[model samples]
Target: MKNNIWLDGLRSVRRMGETAVVAAKAGIKYAIEKPSNARLMRETFEDLGSTYIKLGQFIASTPSLFPREFVEEFQGCLDQTPKLPFSYIQEVLESEFAGRDLGDIFASIDEIPLASASIAQVHAATLVTGEDVVIKVQKPGVETILYTDLNVLHWSTKLLEKAVPKVKFASLADIVEEIKTRMVREVDFIEEAKNIDDFVNYLNITHNKAATAPKVYHQYSTRRILTMQRLHGVSLTDFEVVKKFTKDPSQVLITAMNTWFGSLMMCESFHADLHAGNLMLLDDGRVGFIDFGIVGQLNPEVWTASIAFMDALQKTDFPLMAENMLKMGMTDQKIDTKILAQDLERLFTGVLSADPQQILSSNPADLNDIMMDMVGVGERHGIRFPRDFALLFKQMLYFDRFMRILAPYTDIYADQRLQMIQTMDPNILLKH
Candidate 1:
C-alpha cells in the first residue's frame, strides 16, 4: 500500500512537471508568434491532454459562467484525440470481459476507430447475433492521467485561494471538486449505461416517440467498455444532411426541445450535454440522443423554481421572473424585487427587440455575451445560480442555435409548436 502511494505521488509530480514543460514551450512560442491569450490557452489545454481538454469543452459549453472571449475561443477545442492502436483496445476488452473470448461476443470490430476522444475511442462492431453496435473503449491509463491532472488542478485552486482571499467567494475549490466528481463519473461506463437506461425509461413513460437514446447491452458493457446500439444519423449541425432526414428541421428542433424538457421532470437525471454533436436527426426521422456520460439533476425546490422561471420568461413577466430567479438561486440577504425587475427589463428589452434576421446571423459569442451580462446582473443583485442551471442554460443556447439554422424567421418563444412549459406534467413533478 505504502509503495503504491509513493508511486502515485511520483507519477503526479512527473505529470505536473511534464505539463509545465509543455506549457513553457507553448508560452515561448506564443511570445514569438504574438497569438491571442485565449488561443494560446486553448492550445496549451489541448497539449495538456484529457482533463484539460474536458475543461476546455466545459468552458466552451457554459457561456453563462465564462467570459465570451474564452468561451468563443475554446469552441475550437475539438473533442478529437489521436486513436490508440487496436491492440490496446483489444487488451482492454479482454481485461474487461475476462474468461470470455472476443470472437464469441463480437464477430468483428473495425480496426479504425469511428471516433476517438481524449478518454475513449469508439469502434463500429458487429455482435455475434448480427446486431451492429458501437464499442466505446477507455484508453489505457486514462484514469491515472485524469486523476493526476485533477489533483494538480485541485492543488492549484487551493493555491489561488491562499494567494487571493477574495477568490474564495467564488468557491473555486468547491467548483473544482464538483468538476472532479463529474469527470470521475464520466469515466465509468456502467454509470453512463444506467443514465441512458433511465433516460429511455423517461421517454417511454412520457410517450415520446420523436426522440430516442441508444440501448446499452449490459452483458457487453463494463466500467471501461460501453457497448451500445449504433445510431445511424447525421449531426444537427449538418443542416443539409438533416434536411435530407426530415423535410421540416424546425419540427425536429421542437421535438428535441420538448423531449429534453420532459426529461427534466420525469427522468432520474437530464441530459446535461446536448451540443450539436450529441443531438442528431436519425435516418428514421426520430431525434437520436447519444452520449449519456454527463447528466444533471436539480433538487425538487430548484426544479420547481426553474420551471416557474421558464414560464415567467416566456410570459415576459419581469416580476415573476425575478421572484423565480431568487427562488432558483442562492441568496443570503433579501434583494429588492423592483430593482431586479428593472434590471431584467433593461437587459432583455434589446434582446427581445432584436430583428429576427440579425439574430439568425448573429455570432454565438454575441448571444453568450448577452446571457453572461444577465448573469452579471443577477450576481450584482445577490443571486448565485447552481452549476446545473448553467448546464441547462447551455443546452438552451444550443437549441437556439439550431433554431437559427432550421427556422430562421420563427420566434421559438412564441412558436405554437414549442410546447416548452405546457409539456411539463404536474403529476410528473409530484412523482419526484
Candidate 2:
C-alpha cells in the first residue's frame, strides 16, 4: 500500500508537466490548421499508460456527466497491460503462498491471462483436486497510484467547475469525488470478496437460477489478490454469439432484469456497475455477473420515495413526481412547491402523453431539453437534487440503455416487468 501510494504520487507529478507540454504541442498543431488537438490529447493519455486508460474507462461510463463527444470518443480507449515475466509471476505466487508449493494447490496454471485490466491481470488456473479457478493478481503499487490519480482528477474537476458556472449544475467535482471513492474501494480485493459473498447469498435466497456470480476462494485471496471460480463464455455485446446461444435473448433479458431488480430488496446492496463487460453468457446458459466492487444502497425513506416516484410516473402524475423529487432530494431553500408542481406536471404530462415509451428509448432524444426544463422547475421551486439523486438518475439512464440493447419494446413499468418487481416481500418496504 505504501509503495502504491508513492507510485500514484509520482504519476500525478509526472502527468502535470507532460499534460502541459502536450497541450502546448497540440495547440501549435491546431494553429497550423490540423485536427490533431483532440487526437493528440487522446494519444497522449494512451501513451501515459494504464492509469490513463482506467480514467478513460471512467469517462466512458459516466456519459450523462460528460460531453457526449468526449464520452463517445473514449468508448474506443484501449486497455492492455504489460504481462509480467514468468519469473515475476513465480515470485508473486511464492510471496502469496510462501511455504506452499504451487504444484500442491493448482493442478495446472495458465501462463497467459484471460483478460488484463489497468490494475490486475486474471489468469485461469485449476486446483490440484480438479477445481477450476482464476487468480486475479493486482499490479503492485496500483492502489497508491490510484489514490494519487484520483486526487489529480478531483483537481481537474475543480478547475472545470471554477471556470464555468453555467456547468455547475452538473457538479463534475462531486461526480469525480464519488467515482474516486468507488474506484478506491474497488482496488481493495478483500472488499470485493465480501461483495461477492453478499451477491452469492442474495442469489441463493432469491432462488434466482438464471444467473450467478463467480464463487470466491477466500483462503487464496487477499487485499491485493483474488481467486475465484473461472467464468467463461461470450460477452453480452456479441450479438451473433448471443443469437447462437439462445433463441430467446428476450427471455434472457427478463432473467437479468429480474435478478438485478430483486437484489435491491433481497441483497444487502445493489450492483451499480452491471455493464456488458461485467456480464457473461456462461456455458450452462446462465448469465454470469462479475466485479461487485461498486454498489449502491438507498435509505429506507429514499426507497419508499423511489417506489412512489415510479408509481406516479406510471400514472403520469407529475404533481406527485415533483413532490417526490422534492422530498427525496430535500433542499434548504424556499420555493412555491404548489406552482412548481403544477408547471412540472404540465411538462412531464406532455412527454408522458407524447411517448411514455420514451422513458425506455435509445433514439437519442435531447435529454438536455428535458433536463433544462427540470432545472427550470428546480430554479422556480428552489429544489436542488443532491448529488446522490444525480447518481441515481444516471444509473437509470444506464438501465435505459441496457434495456434498449436487450428488448427495445418492453416497458419496464409494464405488467410484463411486474413479475420481477413483485417477487420481493412487500413487507421489506415498511422498514425504519
Candidate 3:
C-alpha cells in the first residue's frame, strides 16, 4: 500500500509539472496571437483534456454564475473526444469481464463507436438475450488523470483567489470542490446506474408514459462499463426533423417541461444537464431523457422555497419572489425585503416586457447578460444562491431556448398545458 501511495505521489508530481509546461506554452501562444480572451481560455481548457473539458461544459451550462462572453464562448466546447482504437476497447471489455467470453454477454458489438466523449465511448450492441443496448466503456486511466488535473485545478483556484480578491466573491475554490464531487460521481457508472433507476421509478410512480430514461443492465455494468437499453430517436436539436415527428412541436415542449418539473418533486435528484443532445424524440413519439451522469438534489427546505419562488415569479409577485429567493439562498447578513423586491421588480419587468419573438432573435449574450444582471442585483442584496438553484435556472434557460424552436411565440409561464405551477404540492415535494 505504501509503495502504491509513493507511486501515485510521483505520478501526481510528474503530471503537475507537465500541465504547467503546457499552460505556459498556451499562455505564450495567446500573447503572441492576441486572440480573444474567451477563445484563448476555451482552447486552453480543451487542450488540458477530460477534466478541463468537463469544466468547460459546466461553465457553458451555468450562465447564472459566469460572465456572458465566457459562457457564450464556452458553448463551443464540444464533448466529442477522438475515438479510441478498437483493440484498446477490446482489452478494456475483456479485462472487465475476465472470466467470461464476450460472445456469452453480447451476440454482436459494433466496432465503431456511436459517440465518443471525454470519459466514455459508446458502442451499440445486441445482448445475447436479444435486447438492443449500448455499451458505455470508460477510457483507460481517466480516473487517475481526472484526480491529477482536479488537484492542480484546486491549487490554481486558490492562487487565483489570492491574486484577485474580487474573484473570491464567487468562491472559486468552493466551486472547484463542487465540480470535483460531481465529476467523481460521474465517472462511477454504478452511481449513474442508480440515478437512472431512481428516475425510472419516479416515472413509473407518476405514470409519466410520455417520457422515459434508459434501463440499466446491471449484470453487465460496472464502475468502468455501463450497458443500458439503447434509445433510437432524433435529438430535440434537430429542429427540421422534429417538425416531421409531430405537427405541434409546442406540445413536445409542454410535455418535456411537465415531465421535468414533475421529476424535480419526485426524483431523488433532477437531471442537471439537459442540453438538446441529452433529449430526444423517439420514433414512438415519446420523449427520451438520456445520460444520467450529472444530477442535482434539493433539500426539503430548498425544495419548498424553490416552488414558492417559481410560483411568485409566475404571478409577478416580486415581494414574495424576493422572500422566497432569500429563503432559498444562504446569507447571514440582514437585508431589507422591500428594497430587494424593488430591485427584482425593475430587473424582471424590463426583461419580461420584451416581445417573445424579439427575445428569441436576440443573441445568447443578451439573454445571459439579463440573467447576470439579476444575479448581480441579488448578490448586492445578500443573496448567495446555492449551486442547485443555479443549475435549475440554467436548465430553464435551455428549455426556454428549445421553446423558441419547438414552440415559437408560446409563453411557457402562461401555457395552461404546461401545468408548471399548479402541479407543485407537499405530497410530491416531500416524497422520498
Candidate 4:
C-alpha cells in the first residue's frame, strides 16, 4: 500500500505539471488569438488529448448538462487525431502478445490504420488460419492517462462544486464520475468484445437476417487488442453510395432501426453511439453496427418510463406524457401533474401540430432547439433526466435525421415493422 501510494503521488505530480503547461499554452494562445471562450476551451481539450477529447464529446452529446453555446461549439470537437507512428502501434501489439511471436498469429497486419481515434486505432489484418479480420489496438498508456486525467477532473469538479454551490447545471462531480465509468469501459476491449457477442446473440435469437455485428475472434482478442471479422461496406451516411449497394436505402435504415429497437427490449445493452459513421450498409445487404466501445443499459424502471413517454407522445396523450416525464426524470419536490400536463400540452401542441407521429425534428439545429426547449421545461418542473436517457434520446434523433434523408414519407411510430414499446415483450433487456 505504501509503494502504491508513492507511485500514485508521483503520477499525480506529473499530471499536475503537464496540466499546468497545457493551461499556460492555452492562456498564451487566448491572449494572442482572441478566439471565443468555447473555441479556446475546445482547442485546449484537443491539445490535452484522450480524456479531454472524450469529455468534449460527452459535453456535445449531453445538452441537458452543459450550456447551449459550449455544447454547440464542442460539436466540432471531432474525436479524430493524428495517427501514432506504425512503430508505436507495433510496440503495443508486441507487448500485448508478450511471449507469442506476432508472425505466428497474424499472417499480415497492415501498417496503415483503417481508423484512428482517441482510444484506439484499427488496422486490417489476416489471421494465420486465413481469415480476414480487423485489429483494434489500444494506444500505449491510454488506461494510465485515462485514470490520471479522470482523477484530476474529479478533484477539480469537487473543488468547483464547493466553490460554487448554486450552479444551474447537474452536479459536476457526478458528471465526471459518469465520464470516468464510460471511458474505463471504452478502453477495455474484453468488455467491448462481450458487448458485440451479446448483441450478436440477440440477433440470432430474434432470427434477424437484415442486421449484424462483427464476429469477435476471442483467441486473438485481449483487453488491449480486439480482433474481429472485417466488414466490407459503405457508411449509411452517404445516400448516393448507399444507393449503389441497395435499391431501397430506406428499407436498409428501417432494418437497422428495427434491429436496434429490438435490442432495447432483447439485448443486455444498446449501441448508444449509432452515428452514421458507426453504422454501415454491408456488402451482404445487412446493416453493420460497429464500435461497441459505447453502449447504454437502462434499468427496467427507466425503460418502462421511457416507453410510456414514447407511447404517450405517439398517442398525443399530454397528461400521460406529463406523468411519464415525471417518472423518467429525477426530482426531489412534488410536481403537480395537471399544470405539468398543461405545459407539456402547449409544448407538444406546437411541435406535434404538423405531424402527430414526429416526436423529433430531422434538422440537427432544430433538434437541438427542441432539446433546449425540453430542458427548459424540465428545469421549470424541477426535473433532470438521467444520462442514459439523454443517450437514448440522442440516438433517436440520429435515426430521425436518417429517416429524412432515406425515407421522408415513412412514419417510424406507425410503421408495422418497428417494434414499438407497446409491442415489446416483457422480461427482456432488463435483468430480472
Candidate 5:
C-alpha cells in the first residue's frame, strides 16, 4: 500500500522531535566515548517509543545506508521492548475480533511469546484442531501509533529535502515512502502468508533439504493476526549449539546458503531481511527461515547481472564488474568508461590490497573504509547505485562481519556461499 501523504506537516514535526531526542542523548555521549553507546541509544529509543524502535530496525536492515556502529546498535532494538501482559494480549484479541471469545479459535495459548518485536509480539498457540502454530498479535494501538509516527517521519524527510539539497542524495522522502509501504504490508498477515507459501514452494522446486519454512494458517489470520506453523530449531547464528547438533557447521552453512541462493531463480521475491535472528537451526539440524514480511524484487536482467557482479567481486575483478553494474543499473548516465573503470580499479585494488590473505583477523574497518571511498566517488561522479544494489552490498557486508567472528581469514567465495553453482569442481570455475 502507498503511504498517506496527507499528514506530511505533522510527520515532519514528529520526526524532528524524535531526531532531536536521539541527538541530544547520543551527541553528548559520543563526544565523551563510543563504546556500547549505540546499544545504549537503541535501549533509549525503545524506551522513548515504538516508532523509533521500528525505525531502528529499518536502519539495521539497510547497513549500506548507515554506519556500522548504528547498524550493530539498532540490531538489538527488537529484544529490548518490555513484553505485554497476558491480559493485554487478551484485550488485543478481543478488540480485533470485536469481543469474540479467544476460546472459540484457540484451544490453548502460551503466555510467553516466542519473540516480541517492536510492532508485534509472537506467541506459540494451538487451535481447536490440535495443530501447533505461532500467533503474531499486533500490539494494542500499534497501527494508530505507527501511522502517526510514520507521518512525522515523512514530514521530516520533506523538510530535510527543502532545508538541505544534499539530503536528496539519500532519497529521504522515497525512503520514508518505502518504509511505510513495507511496514503496512508487514501488518497485513495475508501478505506474510503468501511470502511463506512462496518460500516453501521455492524450496520444494529447488530440492533444498536442509532448510524449511513453517506452514501459514489462513483461517485464523487477519490484517493484524498472523498464524504460522511452529518451527523448532536453534538460530543459525548460534555457532556453539550448531556445533553440538551437527559435526559440520560448514555443511549446514553450505546448505543454508544454497537454499537462499536458489531462491533467486524460483521465488517471487528474494528474502531481503535475513539477519541471524530470522534464521533457525531445527531439531533435525535443518535451517528455518522465519519472518518473510519484507522482500526485494529484481528484474531478471538485474538478477543475472547481480550474479555476475558477485562472481566478479569474488574474483576481485573491479573494471569488468563496474561495467556490468552500469549495464544492469545505469542506462542514461554517460559514464566516461575509462574514468569509471580507473576509479573502480583504484577503489577495489585498495580494498583487495588491504587484506591480501583474506586472513582470519583482517580488519573489517578496511572493508568499510573502501566502501565509504566508493560512496564518495559516486557522489563526486554523479553516480548512485539503485536500492537493490545497496541492499545486496549490505547483505554481503553483514556476511563478511559474521565470517570475521566465525571463521576469520577464510575466503567466503571459496567456502560457505559458493555451492549454489553446480560445477563438477567448483574450484576450477572459481579459479578464473
Candidate 6:
C-alpha cells in the first residue's frame, strides 16, 4: 500500500509538470496572439489532446451548462486528430490478439485508415473467411492519459469552486465527473460492442427492414479492438448521394426517425450521436446507424412523461406540457404550474411566429438559442431538466436538419407515419 501510494504520488507530480509545460506554452501563444479567451482556450484544449477535445465537445453540446460565447466557440473543436502511424495500430492489434496469428485472423487490413478521431482510428479490413469488416483500434495510452487529464481537471475545478465561491455555476465538478464517465465509456470497445448488439437486437425484434446497425463480431473484439461488419453508404447529409440511393428520401427519414423513436421505449439505450456522419443511407436502400460509442437511456417514468410532453407539444396543450415538464425535471423550490404553462405558451408562440421551421433548424446558432430559451424558461420555473433531455433535444435538432433537405414541408408533429406515441401505446394518442 505504501509503495502504491508513493508511485501514485510520483505519477501525479509528473502529470502536473507535463500539464504546466503545455499550459505555459499555450499561455505564451495567447499573450503573443490577441485572440478571444474562448478561442485561446479552445486552441489550448486541442494542444492538450484527447480528453480536452472531448471536454470541448461536451461544452459545445451542453449549452445549458455553459456560457453562450464559450459554447459557440467550442463548436469549432472538431474531433479529427492526426492519425497515429500504421505501425502503432498494428502493435495494438497484435497486443490485443496476443498469442493468435494476426494473418489468420485478418486477411487484410488497409494501412490507410477509413477515419481517425481522438479516441480511435478505423480501418477497413477483411476477415480470414472473406467478410469485409472495419477494425476500430484504440490509441495507445489513451486510458491512462484520460485518467490523468480528468483527474487534473476535476481537482482544478474543485479548487476553483472553493477559491471563488461566486463561481458561475456550482456544477463544475459535476460536469467533470460526467465527462469522465462518458470518456471512459467511449474508450471501452466492449461496452460499445454491447451497445451495438443491443441496438441490432432491437432491429431484429421489431422486424424492421428499413434501418440497421453494423453487426459486432464479438469473438474478434476486445476492450481496445472492435471488429464489425463494414457498411458501404453515403451520409444522410449528402443530399445528392442520398437521392441517388432512395427515390423518396423523406420516407427514408421517416423510417429512420420511427426506428430511433421506437428504440427509446423498446431498446435499452438510444443512439445519442446521430449526426449526419453517423447516420447514412446505405447502398442497399437501408438507413445505417453507426458508431455506438455514445448512447442515452431514459427511465420508464421519464419516457412516459416525455411521450406526454411530445403529445402536448403537437396539440399545443400548454398545461399538459407544463405538467410533463415538471415531471421530467427536478427542483427544490415550489413551482407555480399555471405560471409555467403561461411561460411555455408564450415561448412556443413566439418561436412559431418567428418562422415555424426555425423551431426545427439544425443551425448551431438557432439550436443554441432555442435551447437557451427553453433552459431560461425552466430556470425561471425552478425546473432543471435531466441530461437525457438534452441528449433527446440535440438528436431532434439533428433530425430537423435532415428534414430541411429531405422533407422540408412535412410537419413532423402532424405526420401520421411518425410513430411518436404509437410506438409506446396505440391508445396513447387518443388519450392525449
Best by TM-score: 6
Clashing pairs in 4: none
Candidate 6 lDDT by residue in tens digits, 220-293:
99999999999998987677778878778888888888998888877778888887778888888899999989
Candidate 2 displacement at residue 70 in angstroms? 5.8
lDDT of 2 by residue, 192-247 (tens): 89888988887886567889999998988878878899887888766558878987
TM-score for each prediction?
0.86, 0.72, 0.85, 0.88, 0.76, 0.88
* Candidate 3 colliding pairs, count: 0
Backbone clashes counted, model 5: 8
Which stretches of candidate 1 lie above 4 Å from their native place?
A: 1-14, 23-41, 63-73, 168-170, 353-367, 409-411, 414-417, 421-431
lDDT of 1 by residue, 1-432 (tens): 697578667777888898889878997988799888788889989989998999898777665566667888987787788889999998889978889999999999999999999989999999999999999999976787899899889888888788998752377776688778889999999999999999898887777888999999999999999999999989886777888777788999999998887777677888887767788888888999999999999676776787687667768899998888888756777899999988998887777676644554323455566667777887788776677887776567667757876888887867888765445555564346
Candidate 1 least-lDDT 10 residues: 356-365
Q: List the residue pairs that clash in candidate 6.
A: none
Compose the digit string of candidate 3's lDDT tens values, residues 87-166: 88888899789899999999999999999999999999999999999999998767778899998888888888888988
Which prediction has more favorable TM-score, 3 or 5?
Answer: 3
Give the better candidate number (1 or 4) by TM-score.
4
Q: Give the per-residue lDDT digits (tens) of candidate 5, residues 123-167.
A: 999988898999998887666667767776788678878889874
Query: What's the lDDT for candidate 4?
Result: 0.82
Off by over 4 Å in 3: 1-14, 30-40, 63-73, 158-170, 315-320, 336-339, 353-367, 421-432
TM-score, candidate number 1: 0.86
Ranking under TM-score, best-scoring first? 6, 4, 1, 3, 5, 2
Give candidate 2's whole-model lDDT: 0.68
| Cand. 3 TM to true fold | 0.85
lDDT (Cα atoms) of all candidates against the true structure: 0.82, 0.68, 0.82, 0.82, 0.70, 0.82
